[model samples]
Target: MTKRQRFLQRTRSRLFSKGAPDYILLALVVILVLFGLVMVYDASVIVASETYGDQFRFLKLQTVWVLVGAAAFAFTYLFDYHNYPKLIVPAIVTTIVLLVLVVFAGPLVFGSRRWFSIGVVNIQPSELAKLTFTVYLACWLAKQKQRSGNLKEAFTQHLKTELLPFAFILFTICFLIIVEPDLGTTAVVAFTALAVYFISGTDALHTLGSFFIIAVMGVLGVLAAIISPYRASRVSTFLETIKSGYAPDPWISGYQINQVLIAIGSGGLFGIGFGESRQKFFYLVGNSAFTDTIFAVYAEEFGFVGDVVLVLAFLMFVSRGLRIARNAHDRLGSLLATGITVWIGLQAFLNIAANIALGPLTGIPLPFFSYGGSSMVVVLAGVGILLNVSKSSEKAVFR
Candidate 1:
């Protein structure tokens, strides 16, 4: 059969053979959101109170985002995800336009122009771009894999067919984000897209070559960081603290992380006990701190046990997502699952890693916990599509 015929067959089968959504995944999502709500409130108390004079300001906005996200989740979950590829073009174009517009017209915050403040709502285009780009890739790679015909061609002709288009798309998205100078979000997108490509059944040797390419890109990124005084200071602080167990300025350069580490350590084995955290009132006291180091507040309030449970919960979420990808009946579903999973999983890892000093402080928000409307909505929507894939997996697709 031709590729079109195969694609039609899979779509038809999906429409007719739909199964119930995964309740375990659904239940797990609820638990995480509820826990995150509590933590966001906990972390944002001082910041909200001082900045907005209402301790409930961030929490209320986040609640609205969560509700909006739930609507987004419902939309993706109920729709046939097999049809997502059809909308890829307009979706991606819209995202790119938004990204470009945000660069020129969005409100400037800190040093980067990354958000559009429209009336009472603020929109971050990069978050939407990340999602749209993932859907585009899942469709492209799945179609490319279908057309490759054989393993030899899949290897020999892969670069021309796969990497060229993939590279262009990936570079376009990453370039916009990097120009925003938001390396944290850019890293998440690139790593997630690379993971999706690697998981799409490429050759082992080519995967190694891909790794080498990524290494070169990483080196370039480091060089770029070194050239900027602000970024250089962050790197130096990270390195210095790593080596000498101290921050340059406990209230300025590395001060944020210095406070974060203190929060984590003071938590002891059982945390400072819920709403009794001392760090939020003084050091980690700001709206930015919620996104940058909310995990530290979490660690301080919940202690070691809370940390373990949260990490384990995220691990379970990722494993189940990967399992869905492994069992997806079609290439599109499988690739989509992989991409979405990597997107969520990597952000979670980077956020926590930064908090614990396991990685550079990227200021990336934790998936559900951080107080950002754009991210919360986009991420929950991704989870919705992932659950839709899980629903499809139960119909004669098991290993």
Candidate 2:
């Protein structure tokens, strides 16, 4: 064969050798995003018109963010996954600086300084923190394993020398996030970090110890909420609604959840038809129709069938992610993939649970389905890294 032909043959072999990126995973993401865009428009049109005199105002902004997220996804997907470990330090530093900046100089929206207003875009540093911390922890744990080996002495020594520092950093980040009074984001970040730690082959004793620390922190969080009347009222309201099966004052304390239930119930089985939700017509107050309670609007429009499909989509996404982690090329890849998966999956669960009043009202956004630019961009970027990890998986190559 000619030299050029031989070179082309080798290139084809190499390109085809790893199979293709997880197309099923990619397809599920695309369906969710496209459906999200439609639902965002459906849920926000009236609110946008009332606030901005344009029905498509939020829709136009969300479209821009979706484009930005797509660009982010492409960049991360094509980039080498192994390079992330090397960049972990810089990523953590940037997260810290941004978190500090948001606390000191960021604009306070709704009495919390969680976002920095950057011209037309508002950046949430906490969102980026979740991704960065996962990368950092995964890299650190992987390196420790390499240095220490699997001997019990080595594991103990590593914990003595490394675990304290890791715990301190984790605690600091969690403290900073909770001080933003965003307990929801704090919970997601902590859960993601702990998941990465657990999957890194930490010993059972250490795992139990870590869980104890987490439980204590959780209790403190509940106490903190109860101490604040505004927050305590939310908890009590949720409890009352649960016990009574209805809110006493739909226009007052339990407004959002009540409206969400109404939207969900009004759909019966098949939904009220797309963009035909009655709750979005000023019946649901605040940002329920668009952000916090978008799922309710979606259910109201598409019904139980749509809800089932959405749940299955998320389940498939998680299944694909876990499979990628199991077949990842190395420990770091596996842990990073696992961390990203847990973050997305747990956050989605919390959002949906809160809407259904299965948990206290915490303003956690549904992953791809929520209408928030910062969340959409960060999550899509994480998905890009996940896809890159899948590309590097030995099992993925054959499949």
Candidate 3:
């Protein structure tokens, strides 16, 4: 058999493995999902009732998603993550096809082509990319081996074997996503993949090269935002607000962030109390009180103490995930653990930062806390995969 076929044969031989799951990791995910459901209902009740004539519309829809996410979590948690290499190619193709289809066939919403309308459900291809592309990168990186210790030969070998293919795939996937004008998701995917690649080995050249590529992509994203009319307006608003202290048109241009600040500011020591946020009524961006800005409404209801608790929960979750990565049984498991952990951690940080004005509004979900079925399902699936990796950690490590 050929070297390629041999690699597949040897790698695929370990089809499955079993071990005790990380209960701490499991507990953190459970807490977040349950808390998210409660907040979805609390934040979405007013608008859901007004538009759908049912205060429980979003809550009910979210509950259905939670159930779907549970099944996805269970499947990924039990399945061997080492078997990912056998399926990575097909997964890559599906991810690309879905991304292209969404851009062409999906309805445009708010000037961006990001999701498909499937009979009372919206699936964001960009979100799916977050999971699939990570799997692709982890599998690819796990297979890479240094050709020769000779620095010159090694550099050239790395370029030919790793960097070239990586750049091509990275640019292609990112091109499709940037066309959707979804920079937030693109950044998360790009950085997560880069982390997996860098963690796969300690090649200084590869690390620097990957960082350079992502930096170039970041520059391109900035240029794209500057050129688009709607995105330009956002850039201008962000600059105007940060430089001075207000937007030119407070009620129109700066409304969302203004409302976010208002909600956060009014939520003093103990907050106005649960479900008692006045901003959730009509002050925030109508229905978005439940989506991109849910954190603001959460802050309004729970106060500073609540914010500290939530932040600490996320910190602990990330710490445990990294520990799992450090103790993974194999290269694939370690990189897989790293990729999943970084993806979720970075997305959560971006969402929270945007809410608090630490960064410009990126319209990304707060993982489990956001009220989107696709997002909830995708995130939980990733968590499930992380948990799967944890099962293979150094004997009873986190058990």
What TM-score does each of the candidates earn? 0.89, 0.90, 0.92
Clash pairs (backbone) in predicted model 2: none
Q: What are the per-residue Cα lDDT tens digits for candidate 1 across 1-399? A: 999999999766655454655566678889998888888898888878877899988789889999999999999888898899889899999999988898898887776788999876889999997788888889887777444657776666876787667777777887777777677888888888888888776667458647755874586477547444576677778888888787877778888888899999999899989888888886774565567788898889889999999999999889888888887878889999999988988899998988887767766889888888999999999999988888878553223
Give the alpha-carbon lDDT of every model.
0.81, 0.82, 0.84
- Candidate 3: tens digits of C-alpha lDDT, residues 281-314: 9888767788989999999989989988888888
Query: After aligning candidate 2 to the native by TM-score, how far in Å is the CA of 318 from where it should be?
Result: 0.4
* lDDT ranking from best candidate downward: 3, 2, 1
- Ten contiguous residues with the weakest lDDT in model 3: 10-19
On the 0 to 100 scale, the lDDT of residue 339 in model 3 is 93
Give candidate 2 misplaced runs (Cα > 4 Å).
1-19, 146-158, 226-228
Best candidate, lDDT: 3
Writing each residue's lDDT as its tens digit, candidate 2 over 268-328 gives: 8999999899999988776668887898998898899988888888888899999989989
Give the Å shift of residue 374 in candidate 2: 0.8
How well does model 3 score by local distance difference test? 0.84
